[model samples]
Target: MPEMNRQITLAQRPYGVPKDSDFKLVETDVPEPEAGELLIRNEYMSVDPYMRGRMNDRKSYAPGIEIGAVIVGATVGQVIESNHPGFQSGDTVQASLGWQTHGVTNGDGARKIDSSLAPISTSLGVLGMPGLTAYFGLLDVTNPVAGETVVVSAASGAVGSVVGQIAKINGCRVVGTAGSDEKVRYVLDDLGFDGAFNYKTSIDYEASLSELCPDGIDVYFDNVGGPVTDAVFPLFNLWGRMAVCGQISQYNATEPPVGPRLFWHCITKRLRIQGLLVSDWADQHDQALREMAQWVTSGQIKYREDVVEGIENAPEAFMGLLRGDHIGKRVVKIG
Candidate 1:
């Protein structure tokens, strides 16, 4: 008898927001790695906003997840067995192994994890994709100079939190917007942002932004689109730069969202807005990770994790993530 592996698969494509019935969990025999392949026992699996897009039946930057297929995700796990020359048993690695407790990969897209530098979980969050997204999205895309005002939407999230901290490290006055008051405090107090506000409770977006960003926004790292982004456009300073990361607010829309037209701000302010993908800077990830690791070690950057235990609970945890229930990076500790 072989060891059994529990896996989560996309049972149905989500219409608007995902529900419990959209995902199905089943057990299967653990697969054996062929020659040149490695077998991994996933320890922690990441739950991200981008996964919401994958659940839809449409083509985008990446292929959509098919029905009854394992949902795509990043995982950190130990290499329980390896036939690949680059890895060995007892070594930990990070790979896009989806929502399975055990998976076999050809080692093409896998990276070895150095546990001595940071926790293995950080490879799925900070020092990993989200961290890399913030590093390049802020520094490369926006190119904020010291003394400029930087604003981040979804400031308490995995990516936005890092974006605000990196801006602060660069000597910029950072302001962030979160969904709740507690989230706002975490961004201002724990992450060292100059100011933050809860967008959910705020009656006037313009007033809130104006009070926090009196100097106007020199650079904006947008994670949640819609009204939050709408409010940001009119607040831009001359020669503003915007990094369009994820549009979490509109990710689950069944129809196109209608909002105030704001492209005119781009023309008037000479704003440069660009979308970013972490893979765009894949060639330079090693260098970026080195610098990010240093910041984490020196306490220049701080991170939090909202962890759920068990593979069975992944769907609920992921649904909560989409609902803005989790404060930080959401991961499932798979058994």
Candidate 2:
């Protein structure tokens, strides 16, 4: 094993969108694991929208990242050394090891990965938190029946892509909205979305949705919350279900977004809107992972990864992700 561990640390609190200067890449001597701990060599780490919230000075559901601390993230890595009874050297495991090439953790929250089941990198994407988020957000939060029209925003993205495919499997008509025309095409042609549109070029979101969803939307999986979400409110059928999965549209905003107060429509249409945190379904994650793995293996669900080659590039790749530069899951490949 290498003697140095490279890490990305928070240099400053970001104002609006994060910039290159906000992060600092530094190296330290790889430390030995204490008792009941495992020393892991991170192979792949995830860059997610939620991490942006953690970069701020204020706190949300989780604590903010302190200055000079390694940025928090999920990683799939191999154990280089272990002191825990449950783990051993060469074991591939998944844990919140943050943005570093090496990390040490007690066995408490770490999960051993069965690499033979799928590529280990998948533990950060389709078969990991993103997959769990989609499963519970759609089926548990909002149960769409067969023949229902399900609309997903950011449809070609990690969680959204899975949500659309799962909805299709359940016999619901799935439509998606993507940031670019290419993404729209992928959602329609590749992922098998019933219909999709490029939100960037659409003159009227309401008109686009109306054209695609001739029948009213019975279930809406919201990933980007903004005008696109506003457009959905007016088109919902009675007792419509909505899983509020993400609000990437507002994550980097310098000011609070002001828009149409569409809650009145929810009252009349009987819409159910609920925010989701994948951790909320932690107890059932193993079951969800097993089922999603089957879907991936059987080709019932297809996924892609947008990978950045090095840990040093994670910040840049993450910024691009916020700008909607990549499709599917964005992950950093570190070794």
Candidate 3:
């Protein structure tokens, strides 16, 4: 058995955007799994915007990642040995192993995966948290309809990209906003968005909405929540629905960014706005997986990953995600 372990440890608490100094790459001996546990080496690890919130000391829906804690993340792993019930040697699984080369699990959170269906790393993406977020966020919250106008922010991201395409598949008129013209083109030309705008260069987000969603927006998937969400707020038609999946723009703000309030419109238009966490919807994942898988296989829905080459590169890629430097779901390859 290999006796080496390479891991990234939290070295310091970050005040804003995390820096290299915040993480320490440490090497040690591989740990032996206890009874009812599995010993595994992590393969691919996920890097997401929400993990940034965990770094801060402030309270959130989930407990923050304490200083010195290995950064928490989703990972794809191969079980090297197991004493856990239902888990076996050589079984591939999705485990919450965080940022490390080796991990031990009680088998409670480890879900067995079949590599025959889709890429296993996809468990961290389109068929995993991001996929589940897009699936339930769109269906349960937005409750879209055929031929209705649906608008989304961060249109080419892991969550937003799938969100928009699923809306399209439902027969909605989809329009999206992304950070670059290239991303806008990808949304419009490739993702089948009826229209898309580069939010970075657009003179007015509301104006862009007016031009693209002349029929008025029936649903808004709010991914980048600062200014872009503000722009979509007023354009919503009566009885509109909004799914507040993520707010990437404010993730790195040193101070709270100023945003226009549209509380009155929510009442006047009878709009609904609610934030959703994918973890809270575990009961419905089987249905989501079956439906989403069919869509991917049928080519009616598409997903993309902005894959970074190594585990050491996750922090940089994640920092870029906060800066809108990436156009799709960011994944770090650890194998």
Candidate 4:
């Protein structure tokens, strides 16, 4: 193992969209694991929209990443040394090791991974938090029934892709929206979404939704909240359910964008909208991961990953993610 540990720290809180200057990469001697701790050589780390919220000073469901601190993230790695009884050298595990090539933990949030079952990197992508988010958000929160029309925004993304596929598994008709024509093809042709459109090129979202969801949207899995959501409000069937998983469109907004007020539609149509975080279903992660792994291995569910090589490029990868530059999950390959 290398003697130096390289880390990406928050240089400053971003005001709008994050810039490369917002992060500072620093190096230090790799430290030895103390008693009860394990030394990890991280291989893959996740960059997610939720991390943006952490960059800000305000607290959300989780604490914000303070300036000069290592950026918070999940990582999959191999144990280099172990003092903990439950782990040993050569074991593969997943942990919240942030944006670094090495980490030391007491195994509080870490979990052992069966690398033989799937690619070890998947513990940070499809078979990880993003996958769990899609599973619980759609199945537990929205509960779409057979023959129901299920619409997902950011449809070609990590969580959105899984959402549509699982909805199909449940016998629902899945419609999706992506930022590009290529993503539209992936959503419809590769992932088997019933219908998909490029929202970037679509002139009228309401008109597109009307045509795609003639039966009305019975379950809406929202990822980008903006005009797309505004367009969905008027087309919801009575007692429709919505799972508010993310708002990527508004993550970097300096000021909240003003749009049509649709609370009346929610009341009149009897819509049920609930915001969710994957952490909310922490108790169910083992069960969800097991089931998701089965679906993935059986080819019943498919996933895509946009991997950027090198830990030094993590800031660039994160910026690109905010710009909708990735097709599915965006992860940084560190070691």
For model 1 the local lDDT of residue 235 reads 92
Off by over 4 Å in 4: none
lDDT of 4: 0.94
Report, for every candidate in turn, its global Cα lDDT versus the true structure. 0.94, 0.94, 0.87, 0.94
lDDT of 3 by residue, 1-335 (tens): 75688777778888777888888777779989988889988888998889888888888998988777788999988999899889999999898999888899898767888889888888898988898999999988889989899999989888999999999888999999898988999888878999988888988989988999998889999987887888887888999999999888787778987767778998899999889999778888878988888888888877777888877777787778777777777888884
RMSD values for the candidates in order, in angstroms, are 0.8, 1.0, 1.3, 1.0
- Per-residue accuracy of model 1 over 30-134 as CA lDDT, tens digit each: 999999999999999999999999998777999999999999999999999999999999999999999999999999879999999888999999888999999
Q: How much is the lDDT of residue 41 in candidate 2?
A: 94
The segments of candidate 1 whose C-alpha lies over 4 angstroms from its true place after superposition are none
TM-score of each: 0.99, 0.98, 0.97, 0.98
Per-residue C-alpha lDDT of model 4 across residues 16-88, encoded as one tens digit per residue = 9999999999998887899999999999999998899999998589899999999999999999999999999
Superpose all Cα atoms of candidate 3 onto the true structure and report the RMSD in Å to 1 decimal. 1.3
Tens digit of per-residue lDDT, candidate 2, span 1-335: 65799999999999999999999999999978999999999999999999999998885899999999999999999999999999999999999989999999998778999989888989999999998999999999999899999999999999999999999999999999999999998888889999999999999999999999998999999999999999999999999999998999999999998999999988899888999999998899999999999999999999999989999999998899999999999999985
lDDT of 3 at 193: 92
Query: Lowest lDDT 10-mer window, candidate 2?
Result: 53-62
Candidate 4 RMSD computed on C-alpha atoms after optimal superposition onto the true structure: 1.0
Angstrom error at residue 285, model 1: 0.7
